[model samples]
Target: MLIGCHGIPVLPPYIISAIVYGSLFALMSVSLTLTYITTKVPNFAQGALVTAGLYTGFALLSINKINPYESLPLSFLVGGVVALGIYLVVLRPLSRRGAPVISLMIATLAVDIIFVGVFGIYSDYLYQVKKVYDAKLFFALTGADFSLFGVNGVVYTAPIALALITASLYLVLTRTRFGLAMRATVENPNLAKVVGVNTEVIYVTSWFVAGGLAAIAGVFYSFWQGGEPDIGSVLLISMFAGSILGGLKSIYGAVIGGLVVGSSEIVVTTLGAQYIGPWVTPYEPGIPLLVMVITLLVIPGGITSVNWRRLLSRGNGS
Candidate 1:
């Protein structure tokens, strides 16, 4: 029911939903991939960090009456602190002790479990103490959203935020001294250390950046979809699927993979429910899993693994 330029009708709610979800997923996938590139450990707690942001924004909204959009900076800081704490307290020590990659990953999973409990406790406190009955579960207040050209505010905000974040990251990574050191550290920590770079500081910075990105994604997610204490855990599979589909090491690939997966998850399900049956709705989560499996089977290296130049040359010759 939205009007486009020239009074044309465009961008139904479902399409807007896809765009917002895809943007947020792309942001999260970039964050997840960044951590993996920096520290060969897959952060299972990434989702929990996202939940932390969700709660932070929710708490501000319910108590202080701060808009979720306005509370994003605080959410980023909180999530960054939590992520940095995990790196410093758990991963750093074990890493120094030469713990295996699997062990480090398991430690992240343990931290994720711990966060679930913490979020649960916080949820209880919010309901009992703050008396926000919907603290345990909540959706975005549509009334608070503005419309432009008949599109919801989030339809503009999510994509714009993703673009800004991506541009900022690109500038930081490719055009700064710290970025040079960080890239060197990522390429080879020992070599970077021997060359006078502080790999530990780079690691800390990467984790903090990753956490902040994930939190920002979470805030957008709450604006696009509803949020709950454990919703991040539920979305963890999708996040991993996006990361894996992107080849896990390429940040740009992660962005593309997330946009593909996120949009398809919602759009495909909606189409199926409209044309096939209602049963398709419940199987939406399977879309990412199926995409992940297909990616693994067809192209283990993911989308970035394909050599576009070679493929184009073949087409020209034909």
Candidate 2:
């Protein structure tokens, strides 16, 4: 009875999917932007980081019989550790050797391959040791969810999580000393070092934070959409599209970019399938690819490059 009082009308599946996926993509895009700004390397392994989180939630929910939502913090911590390990084992050594940016980027691709291999092994081990079903199987927590205000818990939780994450990131970047140091390090590592900032530590911490956020996004994604070990690879194109659309240099831009990409992916794909023929459904993956190419061609600097002040001034004058 109490739940009934607070019930809000439900939305169409397309709209609901857009909101949920948009929020998740926002978290991922922002994390990728942060990694790019600090490390100057577009970490291809970011999808793998999200997969790591999804697997963490899977273990907690399926094996431990805990609420899937309850696993977020642990997933975040584990993701941070995984990201830090990558830096220590692969990227940091390459950086120390004075590798070019292209080399560093390639190194990230190598890390992605390594993580894919690791996930494959881990999936096998989960089945053999814990009697868990094939970890590569697509699975969702739809049955595990409770409703709120007559909406699927995921519908509300995803947006709420996005708000909290965005607010928290803003505060951390603007109000904290670490944030200041991080910004200094990102702007100019040598200058930051001259000013006594530990650039190496900052870089490591940034990677950890980025990985942690990606993990949280993955947790929500698993709740809304079933996941598998290779799910990250499948989602990587969309994540890259969101990050690139936002202007890889600006974290704030990532929010807008992710929302745009996510919303368009669902809405456009659904509409296409409805009107263009059901056969169009399988081509859904091409949406993000199209967006990426268009963005690169039309706005390589992303939406951030637009001169808002000039546009406003012209409007006022007119």
Candidate 3:
């Protein structure tokens, strides 16, 4: 941490934190992108699943007294299971009817409402209630950095982890049958089905996969940010920015969007405080939203949509 001239500031670590935070955003965006891909709907309840993910991580890490790192995987399981239930009870029936856009949006919004209400009840329950888990465990993951592909003075771990996760996802989407089925459903469900694919199964699996990815992101979020219901309420904004940046169509676009959203946030916080000095508190959150709007208005196509096959061919050629 260093200060520039005229009380200007430099905190490289926070920039890295932005990347980590952005990675968390990316994880949620992955789920969001997938939902958009297969169902051709935004899955507005994405934030709800994000909250569920946070709770799952908090449950395993705080309530179960599990080590936070080891407890991480449990969060993904919980996310997947919850998403599966949501699709079965809520989304599947509607999709069967070929629900219209507004209908699907309303349905997912209803799910979001349910999630918010339930989480509120839990928050109240935990409030004057006994702490079943060690609150100390919740505070354990303070500040830290990791070093691979890091500058000598600055270490970057979150971004590195996120990159690894993104790579793994890319491989899955490009190199697997399930991936093809998933994309097939995205391109055209009827056509995919006509070609001997089970579109229904693809959708259900997509929801599960999306929810699970949200959980993985949520776990890191709890690790990165201390877990609480309020955080979940606020996370929707970040997720939305990431999705919009990714063109809301391509998977890799979401990755770039998450990074941009994250970077925009950190940059604003850093520079805003130094220049404006007073409006900092209220202005920070809006930076990404502001950036998102400008980007949408400017680059309509977003981050250049690459045919997955083209990207793969280039990689092989290289």
Best by lDDT: 1
True-structure lDDT of candidate 3: 0.72
The TM-score that candidate 3 achieves is 0.82
**Local error of candidate 2 at 213, Å?**
0.6
- Pick out the ten consecutive residues of candidate 2 with the lowest summed lDDT: 1-10
Task: Write the residue-wise lDDT of candidate 1 on 239-294 in tens digits.
Answer: 88889999998888899889988999989999999999998899999999999999
Over 1-318, each residue of candidate 2 has an lDDT whose tens digit, in order, gives 122343645577788899998898988898888889987888888899898888898878878888778878999998888888888888889888999999998888888888889888888888888888846685667877778655678889988988888898889879998888888888888999999998888888888988898898888888888787778888888889998999888888898888888888899989998998989888888988998999999999988987889989999998
So what's the TM-score on candidate 1? 0.96
Better of 2 and 3 by lDDT: 2
Give the Å shift of residue 130 in candidate 2: 2.1
The superposed Cα distance between candidate 2 and the true structure at residue 49, in angstroms, equals: 0.3
lDDT of each: 0.88, 0.85, 0.72
RMSD values for the candidates in order, in angstroms, are 1.6, 2.7, 6.2
State which candidate has the highest TM-score. 1
Write down the worst ten-residue block by lDDT for model 3: 145-154
